[model samples]
Target: MPLTRRSLMDAAAARFGWRRAYGDTTTVDELLTEQSEAAYTEAADHAALATAKNTDALAVQPGVLDTRGRILADVLSLEGVLAGARSRSLPSEVVKRLEDVVDHGHEVTVLLAAAAVRAAAAHTSSGN
Candidate 1:
């Protein structure tokens, strides 16, 4: 079986945006994958939704996309220039270590923030 661009758009619209007009939307992991084809598939789905409805209603707005793109560019630039170096200014292995650290930092920051807020809320509710 084969699909035209039109059918792809229709299917994406069903998977994304306002299908039930106020229900659970797909997670980022669900929308993207390591497979390049799946990446295109998700883009097609997202494109379909944009074409089919108001783009402003998107749960994950496009500004976040710009921010993430900048972060990715910074990461790649550092990796290309500084990763695995034998120099003193910035060793290549140091860059690799930083990459691993940054990767975990994202999750760690989230957990730290959540814990901070949780503790604050508990203290406030308990009234000392």
Candidate 2:
């Protein structure tokens, strides 16, 4: 049978072990919409925290490198998940959510790099 959105969502739910509470009457679209909102919010929160931490680290020393490393790892992990979702023919909405998460991760990396540069310049001028 051709893959309808419902079929793909059902398959994804099974494969990813996504389950609703017993007797829950939520439709798949509703569930996906909730999950998408949650994913976006969580990613934004994480990116904000990471950006703050990296900024603090830059102020203190060159430890921002370690934070950047972790950010890169997160970006890679998100990319992997996105690739898997695409490969499984998940819904465009789901894929888009994942892409947004990945984009947030990338933004954190960029912020970290800029902070590191500023920190390095400050340290150089201060002869620290």
Candidate 3:
């Protein structure tokens, strides 16, 4: 089957931790403009869409191959964004979406990494 949203979510759940979504919420775009200081500046800002992009791009955390560390990166990245957004009072909806995306992204990343790890493990264990 193709990699649908359901596949992604399932993979994420199996590799990382489970995921849950809250009620409808605003998105990061709603809170900050593309040209806003937060969005443009290199500095870490919740209002900055760049920060969110970076978080998404970075995606996987170090040692995500290790089951124990699967969710750490996702949690930290999400927390950082949330902290920034909350401190700046970005809209509640923006905050909610940010949290949701981060959490889901974390799951996806960890799942992808875990699959790599499993492949490597199999290769090593099989001695070829």
Pull out the clashing pairs in model 1: 83-92, 84-92, 85-92
User: Could you tell me the lDDT of residue 119 within candidate 1?
Assistant: 52
Which residue pairs show backbone clashes in model 2? none
Candidate RMSDs in Å, in order, are 16.6, 9.7, 17.4
lDDT of 3 by residue, 9-91 (tens): 75788787765452444433433343375445654553464445434222223333444354666577678979999899999
Candidate 1 lands at a TM-score of 0.27
Give the whole-model CA lDDT for all candidates, comma-separated: 0.53, 0.77, 0.61
Model 2 misplacement above 4 A: 1-59
Residue 17, candidate 3: alpha-carbon lDDT? 75
Task: Using lDDT, give the best candidate's number.
Answer: 2
Which residue window of length 10 is worst by lDDT in model 3? 54-63
Tens digits of per-residue lDDT for model 2, 1-128: 22366567667788888843324545645666766987999989878876777554345445666789898998998899899999999999989999999999999999988888887787677776
* Candidate 3 global lDDT: 0.61
TM-score, predicted candidate 3 vs. hidden true structure: 0.38
lDDT of 1 by residue, 1-128 (tens): 12355347657888876232223344333333324666787989877776766333232334344445566566565555444452445665666787676675455545544555565566567674
Is 1 or 3 the stronger prediction by lDDT? Answer: 3
